[model samples]
Target chain A: MYRYLLHRILQIAITMFLLIAMVFILFRVMPGDPASMVLDPKMPPEAKALMKKQLGLDEPIYSQFIIYMKNLLHGDLGRSFYYGRPVYDVIMERLPNTILLFTSATIISWGLGYALGKRIAWRRGTRFEHALTFMGLLFYSVFLPWFGLIMIWIFSYRLGLFPLGGMITPELWTAGGAGIIALVLDVLHHLALPLFVLTLLSFAGAMLLMRSSMLETLREDYILTARAKGLSEKVVRDKHAARNALLPMVTALALSLSFSMSGGVLTETVFSWPGLGKEIVSATLNYDYPLAQAAFIFLAAIVLMANLVADIIYAYLDPRIRY
Target chain B: MSFFEIQGLRMHYATSRGRVKAIRGVDLKMDKGQALGLAGESGCGKTSLGLSILRLLPNNAHITRGRILFHGEDLLRKSEEEMRRIRWKYISMVFQSAMNALNPVYRVGDQIVEAILAHEDITKDEAKERVSELFSLVGLDPGRAGQYPHEYSGGMRQRAVIAMALACHPELLIADEPTTALDVIHQKQIIEKMDELREKLGMTMIYITHDIAIISETCDVMAVMYGGKIVESSKVRDLLRRPMHPYTQGLIRSIPPLHDSVGRLTSIEGEPPSLLSPPRGCSFNPRCAYSRDICRTSEPPLRQLNGGLVACHFAEEIPWP
Candidate 1:
């Protein structure tokens, strides 16, 4: 197992390296330069050239790549010209918000999905199963941006139950004497709509996967054995069948969590929530290379880690899965 | 009353095509501590009969009419809760495919522990102790009980499943082709183990298999099934000596003799009838050598014959060897 872990870590290192190279190449290939974004267009060519040189853009691509790699080794992500701040600090400021929003949403969605999926699978031929399956599919396939808009319109705009957009109320937050509990509640109140939208959209995938997996599990001979053992229907369904059915959902959860960590681009944008997703979009548009590349690299690193965690968890859960 | 009795039992599977008549009207009786072997071709509903006793048939299957009386009480009339209590405690099964009958994710011993814990009001430690005792009873190493099902060999897994079936000392044990997937050596080992258990515990058993030879070796009474109905049932010695039903005679002839020189092994021709749409009258009429117009027009009811039962229209007329 240790050897396998070492091999996987080595593979992750190579993959991260390739991803870093891809991020560098793709950002450089895109039109627009950081120097141009920072310098006024009417400036003299000499002043622009000096600014480009200062930003190290005048060097050939290979040397620039080497310098980027060296800086990366020292955990330097350079500076965001658009924000006029270190890229690491800018991303760090947004990472926790994105994690808090997406991770909680994913966990909550999957918890509901798994609970419903197992029941629907067990009661497969019943009308209740069909109704739940249809509704879950509808929620799963609804366009995310449009759904987010509708959620905002219904809950925030028309109902006036929540803030229309943004992660917190600027006025109340800026007033500065609010207790920590009140501030946390305010953040959560702002979080309600986007979290609901994301959860509804994401939960269907887990439901469908778990339902199919559970259906297959129901056919296994061991289920019959469990039933014949006089286990209550609930124990047979949950302890025996659902436990085995949960294998595939583990991988699914990990992949979805890692993917969503980049932030739900449309969700954050729709809510005007200051998450890494929205930051990445604006950083890319403004030709902030350090911030954009760092965000993308962070996403790749997280995806790799999630996969590793999923493997470990799967091996632990299923005795058949040897390293 | 007999220790276990099944009367007018009928079951069907509701497939998309239509209802498959898996178990036609059948009756069987067993005394306490007796081992009855059910011999039949594949898809003859032997497994269904076992599942029916435990009330563990698949959702698609329905017991259209039946009375499974265990110890003078109708098992079919029992509620689901009652059946749950009866199962594993009063009756348990060693499934047809013993290897897959165990959960792959759980330790083999733990699964038996679960079964014991499910029905018995015992501490976990007591259940664990029972599991170890069961493992040793089935000739498996008690130390290997911690291993998962996948870790055990096919024969060892079959033995583990037997151990699980015996965990609660069920009054009736159903051994469904317990040695079907094993090699010749393992088959002998399992048969010997089962025989030892039977002698030691004297528990009522129903062994289902297609191999008449195995049935003859291990069972006191044997029943021959054809197209989801028992056509002949007698003492294993009597059934072998005088197979009144042509189908039973044909099945016996199909078996290879041990001491005979090289000769043609006679095989019964024609496939088993599909249960979805069986023949209009007797299920085995099409395949019976003695089949006549009357045989094709009416079903034969199981009737007493020479201190046993036979379901053949011309049982007396068909001269025996």
Candidate 2:
């Protein structure tokens, strides 16, 4: 087990290094000059040159890469040109909001999907099962932004059940009189619409995957053995069938972190939730290369970690999995 | 009343093309402690009959009509809850393909313990003890109970499966091709083990296999199935010595002799009839060498022939070579 862990960790480290380099190169290849965005066109040529030199933009690509690597090793992600602050601080500030919104959404989606998928697969030919599968497919295929808007329209605008958008009631947050618990509750109230949208959309993927996987597991001979053991239908389905079916879902659940991260972009935009996804988009639009690169690296790191966790969890769940 | 009896049991599988009549009007009876061997080619419904006895047939397969009477009670009339209590506790099964019979993820011991705990009102510790005993009963090492199915060899897995079937001291054990996946040496060992267990426990057993040789080694009574019907049945010695049904004769001839000089081995011609639409008369008429005009027009009914049952119009007329 220790050897396996060492192997996986080494794999992750290599992947992380490659990801960091890729993020750095992708930002450089994009069609934009950082200096042009920061400096005015009316400025004198020499002033612009000085600013470029100071920013290290005038350095050769390889030297810039070396300096970038050096700074990265020291935990510096450079400064955000737009925020005029450390890119790390910018990401740290908004990271919790994204994690709060997407993490909760993902866990809830997977749990609900697994339960529904197990039920539908067992009761496969029934009308209820067909209807749920159909609805799952529909929810899965729907446009994310449009779905978010529809949820906001029905639950927030028309019914007045939740805030229309944004992460908080600005006036309430700035009022200074509310307690800490109230402030947290206030954020959650604003989170309701986007969370619902993200959960519903992602729920379909997990449910469909689980349903098909479970359908396959039900055909295994052990299921017949389990039934012959005089186990109740519930035990046969839940313990024997569903437990085996859950193997593939573990990988899907872990991989979903990356999916939800990309998904976070649209979800955050639609809901105005101030998460890393929103920060990444705005950083990219403003050509804040350091912030965008750092954000991509962070996302990549999380996805790689999730993949590693998936492998470990898979090995733990299935005894036959050697590594 | 017979210890166990199946009367006119007919089972069919619903498919897109049509219903596949997997079991058709099959009647069988056994006394307590008797070992009955069911021998047939693949898809002859031997496995289906075993599944029907346990009520373990898949969703698409339905037992259209039957009365499975165990100890004078009709098992077909029992509720699923009642069937659950009867399964494993009364009639357990050692499934085919031992390689896949056990769940891969669970520890082999735990799987057996689960079977014991399911039907018996035993604590987990008691169930584990029973699992250990069962492991040793099937000639497996009790210490290896914690290992997964993948860790065990194919023969060991079959033994583990047998241990599981015997976990609750079931009155009847149905072993379907239990040795099919094993090597010849393992197969012999398993057949010997099963025979020894049957004698030691004095438990009623139905060994389902295509190998008549295994039946001769382990069974007192042997029944030959064709398409979905029991075409011939008798004492294992009597059936092997003088197989009456043409299909049964062909099956016996197909088994190569141990010491006799090798000759051109005779194989039964043609595939087993498609159950979706069986031949008009005898299910084996298309494959029978002695098929006649009447044989193709009327299905032969199983009837007494000497001391045994044979289902062929020409059973008496066919000359023994």
Candidate 3:
């Protein structure tokens, strides 16, 4: 087990290294010059040169790579040009909010999707199952920003029930001595809209995959053996069919993270929720190279970690999937 | 009353083409402690017949008509909840592919223990003890019980599935091609082990297989299925010694004689008739060498011939030609 874990960890490390290298190359190859984007066109050529030299943009690409590697080793992610502060600090501040939003969104979507998918696979020909599949496809294929806006228009703007946008009531931040419960409740209330939108975006993928996977699993020979053992439908479905069905979905989780994280970007932006997704967006729009790079690295690390977790789960769920 | 009896059992599979009759008007009976072997070629409905006894047919395959009387009570009439209590407790089944029959993620012994716990009011510890006993009964080392199905070899896995079937000491054990996927040596061992278990436990069993040779070794009574019907049924030794039905004779001849003959092996001439739209009268008429005008025009009713039953118009004739 330890050897297997070591093998996986080594694999993850190599993946992360390659990812970092790839992103660095991508940022370099993009057409925009960071120094020019950061400065005004009216600036004199020598002043622009001085600014470029100061930012180390004039350094040889190899030397820049070395400096990037050195700073990375020291846990430095460079500085955000627009924020004029450490990229690490800026991301760290909003990291928890994105984690809070996307993590819950993902878990809820997949969990509900998995349950519904199980039923859909079992009652494959039923009208209700067909309706759910249509809904899942509809929700999954709908434009995210458009969907989020529509939800806001219905639930907040017109109904006047929810906060229209942002993380929390701006007035509440300065309200001193508000108990942690109220504070938490206030954050959740603010979180409600984005979470729902993100969750809605997240559902369709998991549901379709799980349904097809479970449908295949139901026909597996072991399932027949399970029934022959005289187990009830519930036990046969849960312990026999769903247990095996859950395996492919578990392996697919790593791959799905990229799409869902991208969804998180749109969901966060629409809600005006200050998270890494939103940070990554504005940073990219402003050509804040350091911030964008850091965000890329962070998201890349998350994907690698998810992949690693998926491997562990595969090992746990399937005895055949040996290290 | 017979220990178990199946009367007029018919299972029809609903396909896009049409309703394909898989098992039609099949009747069987087994006394307590008797081992009945169901033998046929592939797609001959032998497995379907065994599955029908437990009402485990697939969703598309419906049991159109049947009375599976277990100890004088009709099993088909039982509710799913009641069937749950009776299944694995009163009857259990072993499958064709032992590798696929056992869940890979679980320890072989734990699966047995779960089967026991599902049907019996026993603690985990008690169930584990029974598992150990079952392992030894099936000639497996008790220590190997902790290992997952993948860790065990194919033979060991078959033994594990058998151990699981015998866990609750069900009155009836239906082994559906339990040795088909094993090597020749394992096949013999599995057949012998099943026979020994039947004798030692005094449990009734329905041994379903395509191998006619293995039947006499493991079963007391043997029934031969053709297309969607049972064409012959009798004591295993008697049936093997003198198979009456033309289809049964073809099946016996299809296998090489053990005493060494220098002739090419004889196999039935045609494929199994499609159950969707079978022949006008007899399904096997196209395949039978002795099929006559009457045989093609009228379905032969199963009738007593000597001490056995044969469903052929010319069962009394000496020479098949």
Q: Which candidate is the best by TM-score?
A: 1
Flag the better candidate by DockQ, 2 or 3: 2
Per-model i-RMS: 0.7, 0.6, 1.3
Q: What are the TM values for chain B, all candidates?
A: 0.98, 0.98, 0.97
Native contacts, share recovered per candidate: 0.94, 0.94, 0.71
Candidate 3 structure quality by residue, lDDT tens digits, B213-264? 7887778899999888999999998888888888888888778877786577
Ten contiguous residues with the weakest lDDT in model 1 chain B? B258-267
Tens digits of per-residue lDDT for model 2, A1-323: 88988987899888888988888888888898787789999999999999889788899988998998899999899988878899989888898888788888999999999999999999999998989989988989999999888888899999999998888888988889999999999988887778888888879888988999999999999999998899999999999999999999998899886656644788888888888888888888888888998988888888888888898889889989986
Off by over 4 Å in 1: none
Weakest 10 consecutive residues of candidate 3 chain A by summed lDDT: A254-263
DockQ scores for all the models shown? 0.92, 0.90, 0.73
RMSD of 1: 1.1
lDDT of 2 by residue, B182-210 (tens): 89999999899989998999899999999
Point to the candidate with the largest lDDT: 1
Q: Is candidate 1 or candidate 3 better by TM-score?
A: 1
Which candidate order results from sorting by DockQ in descending order? 1, 2, 3
Alpha-carbon RMSD, candidate 3: 2.1
Note the chain A TM-score of all models in turn: 0.98, 0.95, 0.91
